[model samples]
Target chain A: MQDREKAFIRALVRSNATFGIGDDGVEISNFVVANDAFFEDVHFKRAWGSLESIVEKCFVVNLSDIYAMNAIPRFCLLMLTLPTDFKEVGKLAKIIGNCALKHKVKIIGGDTIAGDKLHFSLTFLGQRQKSRILTRQSIKKGDILGYMNPSSVLTHTKTQAFGKNTKILKTALRFHQHRKIQSNTRFAKPILYPKMLLELNSIARAGMDISDGIFMELPRLSHLNRLGFKVFKPKGDWLYAPEEYQMLYAIPKNKLKKMQNFAKKHRHSFVPFAKAVRGKYRESKKNWHT
Target chain B: MQDREKAFIRALVRSNATFGIGDDGVEISNFVVANDAFFEDVHFKRAWGSLESIVEKCFVVNLSDIYAMNAIPRFCLLMLTLPTDFKEVGKLAKIIGNCALKHKVKIIGGDTIAGDKLHFSLTFLGQRQKSRILTRQSIKKGDILGYMNPSSVLTHTKTQAFGKNTKILKTALRFHQHRKIQSNTRFAKPILYPKMLLELNSIARAGMDISDGIFMELPRLSHLNRLGFKVFKPKGDWLYAPEEYQMLYAIPKNKLKKMQNFAKKHRHSFVPFAKAVRGKYRESKKNWHT
Candidate 1:
């Protein structure tokens, strides 16, 4: 069913589509329309966070699509289906409103209904100058493939927080026991760099926000452009790790230095992980799990 | 939780909002954004009809919101969350695509995910010329209230085909057994008259598509305008019956005749059921049940 779903959606892509089903969002005219669905068990368990964190994450995940296209998000429509037995509807709305306010995205409209499980669908409307919009179709062979590496907070929080002293190790054991709470507080949120990306949009040919891991998205980018990728640092299982809201981009090799300087100026980091190659969707000779 | 949800949404309605949470959709900058959710057991069952009919109904219901505002639908973003075990994904996509093609509305983007239950959310983007937009805020006290009556096919199909005679009654039972099949085929479809409504947009002040029965919508329209309604013919239970795709409007008393003529010319029917009155939010003095 999943394979059939992909094939069906691919068949519906139209010529006017700037980004189709496989990409982060779809662009038409000057606007980008994207919707993301987060289910209870699929995306998060109740024990993972508070209702506020869950609501905030929903906004972040949906807005990430607009940011991936280097577009300025303007408005959002949130549709929430809640279980009949659930409470705290007001808290969820308050958190969502706060998130929207912080991001300057207006909550224009939505629908709320009672269902068997908790589900949220947020549709984001964003705009970008036509020439500045990024898509997966414009990648050329030899363009540098780069990724916004997971932020230090996300990476450090996922590892043990303390080093190897016996006394500290005993205390770290207690802290590690509370790691789930700490991790949810810091790393469950989406990282957005819309303004920075918009400033650098001209330097990149095509890009996508990584939600379904780098391995899955690389083939999609390659399939769309009739090209292949060669990863240089393919020595870890990070290729399959879910990076959620990180982004992958195809940059011209000549502009890599400029982008690096701009990233430094903005205090952002872009790691060059792969390079586009002329072939039929083949990966590098290096194994993904070396 | 339901009450809290309503209160929370009402609190978020901004000053510039033409219609907010309680209305059919929201209007901003000449475009109306609306989203509707249809769930498996709550909206339809597998025994109700074919998958094609279900998919078609989804488009019709979403498009009706644009028609209610006398706007031209431009684009749609669909979000479907289907059970992992479900098949027939391709057929669902095909029907949705055909419906969009027929309506001249572009299916720009969408998301499909796996969920525990079957759910579909459609966000419609529609536009109206600034002068042609209809909103609840413009309704006047003395305006005439009108509705697009449910078509004969939707009405008569609800009653027994045979009125009198034992011979006919025996055959009617067998025919009635098949009525569910027929009703699902014809009445379950959404009826849209966007072009005609756009032509008549000037005559209407405030309007909304009737999805949650006329009785329910009447109170909402009245509450929004701080006025009341007086129904002339209040003895029928049609007020409570779910007329999924009909429209209700507030027209000026003087323009009622012109609207009637226009409806005739367009092969549409406008039934004037009530009048806007200066009072608190109350229904007609006439009883709803005879």
Candidate 2:
């Protein structure tokens, strides 16, 4: 395509396409869930990543959502945009099915669309006990912030933090760990991340998955409590981003030891990012006296 | 486009672009309602349709759905594949949002691509009283089949049924009886064939809004029941094709009179479609009538 043609396509992508879907306007269950993710060229590009990694990364990104609500996902509705090169639909299905099954989730429903790039969306629903439900508006002042992840958190979502480190936006491709999936889509074991379910119950004051970034996310969590956070220590291969959608929760001070112990039992990582303090958002940021 | 390109685009439109969402997916409280309509060359001047109509029609079709479901529609996700002239993003959103706001729906989400002819897929979601909802599954076998609109009844969404009716589809271009708005999107509502909300909880038997021919729809309801039907007479614009989804449900045998009385109170067009019989689906066909 020529300059004008490429510009036309770029404009088409940026200014919403010929189709538009309504946002969250319907009544849903307390823990209702919906997720969407994109892969290369259209959203990112394979020239910088591999398809298997792309698929695995997609799973983690969406699963980050179930972790956010602290709900166990039951079913997922997938909307997949297939590129012309992907002729083996059956193989792709098995790839997705195996990945989801290992997480104790199912690919019960989804859609497939053929497009220039690989993009997929999942509209899934899961349940949370009515009393244990988490929402953005639930954090209270004096609550403590908890960040969980096995190691580094990398996700191919529109996160803001890792962009400065990797110099890429909208994807967390570990070009350093690239490998080819043979013509056959087979993998020996499941690709697992900071497995953080079964550890969050009554402990979290409020929480959200950090698809955006730990940098932008901590501030968001702190705002919930009419508070500010002093993120004391930033650990792990922080610069090595993978699909790190570990849980970020605001827990009461009293529950710290208990939540950490619970994390230990499940072999999940847990860390204290900052404390919820009462103050203006900017004041807290400036005085984030870690 | 070459023959291969045209054929490829056609397949994509049917299977992917407008992948019948609600019927095939993991069922939720249908957040995104759907409506798909097709008109040949006459629906618009050959070149005028563009990708915009693909977006607009999905909104239009689903606006009727939001009404049918007794919900205030809020958002729509559209999918469209167009021929060469489909690049005007601003123009597309202009028409879509105009039609959407009339129903108070917004243009929050979107997707698009290229194709030979114009095909539109609109998925919309809205909010309504959980208790006062409507669906064909709730209709009883003996309940009455009422024509809410004395105006029109084109029950098929099939191409052939829609193909023979350009004269009726042309009515869309003329100013409709519905209110006209100054927002760039004007309207001649497609002779909206609406069902009454008040009729939902009434004594009506299993009901469906008529989509495919009453001939096609009633039998499906029969299959749902151990009952069969004997339609002595059919109602509405029989010459016209089915206009999107317009199915109503069957009346329970015991409550037919009460349903009739209820229909009368609400001013519903409850014509007795057919009487239930214990027969095979083939026998229910108009030609196979006893």
CA-based DockQ, model 1: 0.33
lDDT of each: 0.67, 0.46
lDDT of 1 by residue, B1-290 (tens): 24545665754553222125555667655578788887776655554566767777777888888777777788888887767777766666666777778777887677777776668898988876666666666788889887765344433343421111122323333444243344322235555667677767777887777665576667668777888888886545446544346667788999999988887676667888888898755443221110
Interface DockQ per candidate: 0.33, 0.10
lDDT of model 2 at position A108: 41
Return the top candidate by TM-score.
Answer: 1
> What are the models' TM-scores?
0.85, 0.57
Over the stretch B15-103, how does candidate 2's per-residue lDDT look in tens digits?
A: 33222223322224545343332322313333333444444544555566555555556655444434465456455545555565555
Deviation from native of the Cα of residue B118 in model 2, angstroms: 14
Runs in model 1 deviating more than 4 A are: A11-19, A129-131, A150-187, A282-290, B1-5, B11-22, B28-30, B150-187, B283-290
Considering only N, C-alpha and C atoms within 3 Å, which residue pairs clash in candidate 1? none
Question: What is the alpha-carbon lDDT for the whole of candidate 1?
Answer: 0.67
